[model samples]
Target: MDFARLTGLIAATYTPLNERAQLKTDVVPAMVDHLIQQGLRGLYVCGSTGEGMSLSSADRKAVTESYVQAAAGRVPVIVQVGHNSLDEARELAAHAAQCGAEMISATCPSYFKVTSVDALVDSMQVIASGAPELPFYYYHIPALTGSAIDMPEFLQLAGKRIPNLVGIKYTAPTLFEFQMCQSVDGGRFDIVWGCDEMLLGAYATGAQAGIGSTYNVAPALYRNLVDAIEQQKWDEARRLQLVSIEMIRTIGRYPFHPAMRCVLGFQGFDVGDCLLPQPKLSEQQAEQLRSDLQSIGFFDWAL
Candidate 1:
């Protein structure tokens, strides 16, 4: 398959819920429109940012359908279908393809903890086979998945086994390993950077694209960072990167995803709060978050 590499900023989108924490899919269209208007280049549905692991399989499918329909070919929607059950992951991948998603991605099953490159390849092959016509990207977030298989080796082996395998969503901070993954098969894979705060470093190491949760709220800031890099303005790029670091630090003070929802609320998106196991912010906490962000001029530059 001749895959068109994903370039520019792609948002790891959030799943909206109601007060009861049920799926509030009606908000999806508005969310998609807002992301595109904010200059995001693509949408990554049902990833960590979207609480994919927490949602039921049915809800994941619904969210995939909603995002794909909302995007309507305006931007590519890459559905993250990873599940502990390979069968469920395969089903989700097929459903994403059936619903018209442009690509599919999945993490290795976390519960069993794949310990070998061959095991990782076999596991992903089961998921990618379901969406044989569409491109597949292995979601390599070792911190979350607990499967820290060497990416360069896995890419080389999986490339031969999985016919539609295109590349990886490299999320770890190890730029050395990331660069090695990029060099595999003579740069055949589309290794998209996943860490938003370290995006400048990734660009310095030859990253062509990035998929991150922060891109949802701060696309303009990252766009300017990329622009500075493209224009060879090292000082401006470093300054913009520092702004992202500080912004992430402020959000990190609270439970990350819930605070991200609070930030979205500030922007009038009404995305509601994260589900349990990820706590929601109180009124006072939300106010304090707003103040911290204001102190850093986040509202001014996040646009």
Candidate 2:
């Protein structure tokens, strides 16, 4: 495994959208640079936070290609290309690999509740076939996808039957679920935690990387968490965890996708509202997040 493949924080970056709600590819490269400056280990583009579902295939490809080129091999960029359509997901997997994405991941296709685990397995197998040589990580989030892959289901996928299946971004709520994945793999497989609030516990339970929504505002905070663990400062690490959990609670409580885009605005990226159904928060909610940010010294750069 590459050093970039080892453990750290991978921010599921938000897309910079235009006033018309189209992806702003220009705004992406700058954020990629900002993340690198803050010491982020990698980035996960086109995931839930990026409004991947709303983006057209061409748009997602453009964004993925642009970031891969702009990164210029500086840091690992993992592209989330899974969607309702298997063909599109396959295309995305191949596109990402061609564009230099370090790893490719896909969430469970959620629109339908199928008869069995084979439904999910078939979706992954199709995507793997699309990118025959690229390494793949399964995106396991039962809440969002309305599909759960218990330990037995996961083991079936990770077995020799599936080539290019190296790990999973287990987005399950509890660290116990992550611990279970570690147990089945003898604690050696890469499991990236998808919950920011649970990241420390996830890491302690053997997660290699953290993939989260709140990371858009606080990549450095998480990068520090990893370092604290390395130094074995358990108590001090808890302080950072407390700070991060508070932020997650604040962000997670609200309509997340939009509130997050607003914060990105203040930070300098000018992305627009969340796609329909994921509407931008009320003006009051925006100000509240802004105030919360100021209270936490998020604007300290101005000082």
Candidate 3:
């Protein structure tokens, strides 16, 4: 399918929330400014990092609107409109198109678990049909969705069926399958990598773009890694990727989304905490994360 080639850092952004855990639309402009200043190429809103699944449909639309407006065409915005309810997902995809989002993506419905690759392709085709003009991406994060359909096979099968099937947000760590997906159709699809910690490995496997939750706060580090790869500075790339791995490891010690919010607060923006299902970190826990990050030189590396 014809689509813009997405490259470099695409941050899977977190939703800014208020004290009452409401959608804090006011903070979006500042968030946009911060990301732009940090050298992010695009924003993937209402995705896993943004707590998309935890939000109501109206709230997700509001968040998407806030980001798209704040961006004001400075950078591309890929809105993740996936939901267990295909109707809701279609509504979201249509809303994203109306708001002028650059692209749309969706994960498989795990509630009923897509039984086969054909079924998966059928669901994606239906969702993509919502915004036929925009490029459609299948969010293949099987680890979270538990939809273990073979992605390379899915790409080969879905490529013919879904006319707008542009690519996938490849989050699984299975490098072999990832490579296979990239080789399909002479690598015509935009296979954006999703694992932040293994970004260097993804690069070696020919990933030109990546989207991740950690990129929300530590974009510079990833950008530097990308630059290093471009310059053929393998050692420097390895070192930079190691630093990112260490940073992700540090945040992994706490509840991921909450710890990420805490990190953002340390960097000067308070996006608030993760909502229900993902518990919020206590003040002490936040402080500890700060201390831990400081000890590991996270501030120096990421900032």
lDDT of 1 by residue, 124-211 (tens): 9999999999999999999999989999999999999999999999999999999989999999999999999999999999999999
Q: Model 2, range 180-290, lDDT digits (tens) per residue?
A: 777665654567788888777877877777877777677777777778987889997898888787776676668877888888877777877887878778889889888
Alpha-carbon runs more than 4 Å astray in model 2: 1-4, 185-188, 300-303
| Candidate models: Cα lDDT each | 0.95, 0.77, 0.91
Alpha carbon lDDT at 223, candidate 2:
71
**TM-scores of all predicted structures:** 0.99, 0.92, 0.98
Q: Any idea how many clashes model 1 has?
A: 0
The candidate with the higher TM-score, 2 or 3, is 3
TM-score of 1: 0.99
Off by over 4 Å in 3: none
Judge candidate 3 at residue 188 and give its lDDT.
81
lDDT for 131 in candidate 2 is 73
Give the alpha carbon lDDT tens digit for every residue of 197-254 in model 3.
Answer: 9999999989989998888788888888999999999999999999988899999999
lDDT of 1 at 237: 99
Candidate 1 least-lDDT 10 residues: 268-277
Q: Which candidate number would show the highest TM-score if scored against the true structure?
A: 1
